[model samples]
Target: MATIRCCTCGSPKENGKDKKNRIEMRKKTKGKTPRRISLRASLRASVRDLLHMKSKPAFVNVSFKTDSSRHRFIQEEIAKYGKGNITSRIFTYSELCEATKNFALQNLIGEGGFGRVYKGYIHDLHQVVAVKQLDRNGFQGNREFLVEVLMLSLLHHPNLVNLVGYCAEGQQRLLVYEYMANGSLEDHLLDLPPQKTALDWTIRMKIAEGAARGLEYLHETANPPVIYRDFKASNILLDENFQPKLSDFGLAKLGPTGDQTHVLTRVMGTYGYCAPEYAATGHLTVKSDVYSFGVVLLEIITGRRVLDMTRLSEEQNLIRWAQPLFRDKSRFHLMADPKLEGKYPTKALYQALAVAAMFLPICL
Candidate 1:
């Protein structure tokens, strides 16, 4: 992996001691409630209901900063990354074409609304990677391409997909990522071939835990918190060891900060995973991601797609189908995937169902 200097956008400005802190300091000298609780102002308290605090994140110092245009911001941040010891490499279009066998169909591994992704081997790095070639005709595709590039480039985490490099030669925009051998969680979790072995309860829990940590890092640790607008199974890729890493940052948004409560943006995300509040109003918050995480958690436990038209009309929606099961604790076990054949621990299943149920939105 090429070295990307992952740091906050701007220099941190210290807050001056104000009247409130002065008074609090007096009280503290007198040995009462401390004046200033924390410089970050109990950041977790606001989203505690959704996030449920457990542990502190690895400390990295970076404060929130924004530029006029997202494109300019991406360019600036990436430029900063370039000053580091080993900067992100800029791959030529022809180099990537050579790697992917001239974009042949046989190497294709994944496709989405953005465009097609193919498995390729880069000779320079002598490493296998996934090359995502963006749709040339779509203007939005270009913006998304840049956004994904900026996000993966700036943000580095164990649970987030690594961006090996990118090819922006001419009009060709493509992203090179570390090849995920196990494909997506959706590949093995939801629909499985008759011959494939089902994912055990332990692995399912581990995947959920890793995914949740990735989301939590975005929400709590990023310089300016990031709202992962799109959180679903297909977006969570698994590695050779079944370790889950969150992917696809095109839909991510810089979350609200200071006094701001949420970000306002057009509704976008996989249908079944969109938070009801986000769908009803464009107000996007870290909780928007938490809600989507809940949906995925349910999917992990049940091994069902968020939406399926082929299913019975009532059960087509996974959340709604889970309602009665949540209401009746005795029936919670029924929500477990039948393919498991009752191998999961009973206590763990109940706790998982409860936590998943808690993640769901109140009205939805």
Candidate 2:
């Protein structure tokens, strides 16, 4: 080895090379520092932008005139309802959207003529809720919304589905209800998928009794009496324990009062479930609901759809098919759900069939 120099003291040539290397390293770092800073800033900015987008409001109104006035009117009307036992909160449009995960398709649990219902988890309340958002394109409108709000807010019954809250912001109209884990009775009875189990006779009878009680409450207990023009299997929602609750008050109308035989209005209900008189003439009454209740009861007992095209042309309509059977006490056994496999008591079957027959429209 050549003569060893002090570690701190380098040869001139070595010093020159070391200095050059240090400068190059500094230059490289200096060049990349701004890029690194920009990248971090860019990431922060991106995050901010994403948050801003999510924070954007739904159904925003540039002119608040109409909305404010209408909102005031709604609040006034609701106030007139005297709160009663209705403790539904008025939720913001944004709150509902967030609760429903912006109304994601995957969150949708059910849909019908009224609108689509979404299953939502409300973080603030720490509860799951059913959010029913009315379809703008559907037959339902503000009138139906108001009817539902008024009817449900004023009426409280064990058999009635609970109204948790409502959202009436801008053009958006939504109703929030307690979640029914078991879904609708129609889901269990008709058009059932292979995976779904048929409802047992005991559950079916329970559902029928609960649904009848719901109708009875509307027709008798409610002030001015209410005619549930839209009563059917689909409107009967079931909880985890298979307890039934009446839902969808959109088509509900006040029953006739003081010697009035019926309330005359535009007829609106599911085709097969509508009472013949109500369908022919827009005359509605508690009896109309009774007729509908009968149809649903018949469906429960027979395990047939209200309108099944699969049957022979003459036997397609459940009411027409059952009418003849209702006349002969011996034929009542034939009306029992085949799924029951004759497991139910014959006496119980006769009594249930008699009740259903009592509800049928007497054809002159």
Candidate 3:
């Protein structure tokens, strides 16, 4: 009998004898587990979430753009199969309109470069949900829409946002997700209303740790290893208990593997959070995300915006303001968020700062 490896369990046995064992293992570990799929030769550009703008689109006439025929091929495949084939619930445009009260302005909870997000109630599921309505002319297009559907449909983890359903009818494109009560880390850390409670040292660290674990899952557990091209505080959503979940798969890229150095692609991300090397060259690697994660970690420690122009020129950039202090252990206290009111642990502060330094680019 020939020896064969079980794809799901990675156990080896005589091909005919363990066939039943393989089926048993798969049945026992159903939806909660991930399927082990092999990596493709190259990831399609349409699979990436490229931020488009009027003056400066995320991707231009770059070399990485997929061939026109290939782009159309994917579009046709998605159109023919539709959302019903993807295993994610499919919602008609009218059904979503009803769920979100006809998408009234009052239901709108958040808006960004891509589109407006609305809070909705789904009676059938007896659950509250977040509905993302993509702008036809905004940064996200049909490619971005399909990419998100496919990515979220395949990837599942505790720290990643759950895709409940999606709407694709006529010209409208929308995504439905499990409602995040606390909103994003950006809301808790950067600007807060007078009565809004501030995140303490412990809560901030917990959120950071959860966000890091989510990235680790994508980078390590996922067979192809996803690179979160746009890793920032705003993308990290929090539930009722302040647990963090990474959202917005629009800019995510599949990491290079098997001795490959990096994948060359267009530089696409927020200005301040982009890694310096990635910005200089279109070469993207797992470290590109690590660099952005560091910036977010720094923001959590200091309670400062990544790039605030209102501050003095020297202090406007958070990284620039904290670099000198990172060298002196005594001044590490200065890096703590003023809102923290000096209540954070001294030793923990040092350890967090040390982690931030590891992510930042070193002077050569």
Candidate 4:
């Protein structure tokens, strides 16, 4: 058997020292009993904590410019609704341009419906950051920029990406976030490069739990609750350690409050992730986000895209393709990602699938 070793995640600097640090870490944790945290139980704890949590002032140390009309209205909306307060610095357009080397083509890390994201170094902050430059041609994209800035300014959590600063200077609508080294979950989980290693079953389960904690913070811990209208593989960023943090708040909306049951808004979100009720009637509840999470969980499990035109028409929709297998416990193994090569535990796979089924909008 090979020698046992431990490695630090999300920290490239620590990778070289894994062997040396192993004994120290084990010594530190040797006397303590390790507790296993389950997805369902962690959610229950989030609710209980919310019930007992006392009101507190803004905990984030924020400093920013506030002169433009946008500043007057675009400050993080979660804080406005009294969810929590988070703050960030304001970056000049020139600074961002300089950081990204005039938006070099090589530094581009990601691009999506909202805009192109580039990796940049901010000298003032003394850190690398992911800069999202909103697509100027998109009119609705402009509104998305406003919603994201306001949402991040106030909401802070380990599972939620940190907003370092923003560039709402003139026609430039850019958001600066702490650099996530490993890139989005979609990068590692979806397409497989022949040389790249596939994610192990345990890592997939761990990512699912972390993503849930982030959603739990938004829905249960936030004062008014936040609906993450767009929850998908691309939006869930990862660090060097493979930890998941929910990013891209451009589509976020505050959930219902007081006697209201749900917030009614135009149906919006990724094609396969939108809840049925939301798509049919535009009634969005926390359940909408749940459905999206379920889709992601399934993606993580089966290594399949939520919607794929390349697959056969019958198998194009991931949920529809898996529903039959979900009914019978014996067929659950059939739904596991082929890439896993059967390395995962059978019991844990069943538990993870059960969580996914529970969050999906329909019964298994």
lDDT of the candidates, in the order given: 0.73, 0.73, 0.76, 0.74
In the range 172-209, model 3's lDDT, one tens digit per residue, is 77999999999999999997777988899889988888
After superposition, the stretches of candidate 3 with alpha carbons farther than 4 Å from their true spots are: 1-76, 79-85, 362-364
Backbone clashes counted, model 4: 6
TM-score of 1: 0.77
What is the lDDT for 137 in model 3? 76
Model 3 Cα shift for residue 269 (angstroms): 1.0
Where is model 2 more than 4 Å wrong at Cα? 1-86, 362-364
TM-scores, one per candidate: 0.77, 0.77, 0.80, 0.77
Task: Report the error of model 3 at residue 181, Å.
Answer: 0.5
Q: After superposition, how far is residue 181 of candidate 2 from its true place, in Å?
A: 0.7
- Shift of residue 34 alpha carbon in model 2, Å: 78
lDDT of 2 by residue, 1-364 (tens): 0111111112143477886897798777863544233113222222223223322211111122464565455544444433343357899889998998899999999987678999998898898999999886687766567667766766678899988889877667799999999999988998777786788888888888888878777765554567778889989999999999999987776566556777677778899998898889887778888888889988998999989998899889998888877777787888888877887877677767766767786331
lDDT by residue for model 1 (82-124), tens: 3332245778789898999999999999987778999999997
